[model samples]
Target: MAEEEKPFICFKNGWNMKIEPRNRKGWLYLSLWMLALLPIVFTFTWLMNRELSTAQSAAFITGFTLVMIGWGFAMSRWMKVRSEVIDMNLMIDFMREREAQKKRGRR
Candidate 1:
C-alpha cells in the first residue's frame, strides 16, 4: 500500500535542518525567502568587507538564527487545527537532540 501523505504545509527535517514546502503557500513563502537572499548576502558581504570583528559576526549569526526561528513559529501559526498550531517546541527539541548526537559522535 502507498504511504499516506501528511497535511503539513511545510515539512521540516530536524536532522538536516531543511524546511521543505509541502503546499502552495509554503512554496510561495520559500520563494519569498529566496528573493530576500541576494540582498541579505550582499549586505553581509558589504559589512564583512568593512571588517566586522569576530564578536559582531557571531552576533549577526545569532540574530539571523533567531529571525529564522521566529519565521518557523509564524509559519506554524499560519495554519491551525482544532485551535492548535504546529508544535515548534517539539521540532526544536528534535533538532537539539540531533545536534547533541552529532556532538557525542565527535567525542
Candidate 2:
C-alpha cells in the first residue's frame, strides 16, 4: 500500500509547506547521528569514573549522564534549526531560478 504524503507545517501564519523528499532524508540522517551518541556518552562516562571511589564513581556517572543528555537535546535542536535554514535557502534559490526561467521564456 502507498503511504499518504504529509505537508510540512509552517509555524508562522499556519501555512502548509512542501519540502523535497530528498531533503527529508537529510533530516532522518541527522536524527540518527544524534541518537547514536547515547551509547558513546554512556561508555565515556563509565570509563572516566573507573579510578574513583564507588560512591564517587556512581555520583560522577549520574551527573555525567544528565549533562550529556541535556547536551544531546540541545545539539539536536540546533542541528534541526540549522537544517531548516539550509532548506529555506535552497527553496529561495529554486524560486529565483524558476522566476528567471519564466522571464527567459517570455523573451
lDDT of each: 0.60, 0.59
| Cα lDDT tens digits for candidate 1, 5-100 | 433333334432334556665567567756756675676567667767899988877876786677656655543221222456687999999999
Off by over 4 Å in 2: 1-51, 83-107
Judge candidate 2 at residue 6 and give its lDDT.
30
Stretches > 4 Å off in candidate 1: 1-26, 33-42, 79-107
Which candidate ranks first by TM-score, i.e. highest? 1
TM-score of 2: 0.34
* Candidate 2 lowest-lDDT run of ten: 5-14
Q: How many steric overlaps are in each model, in order?
A: 0, 0
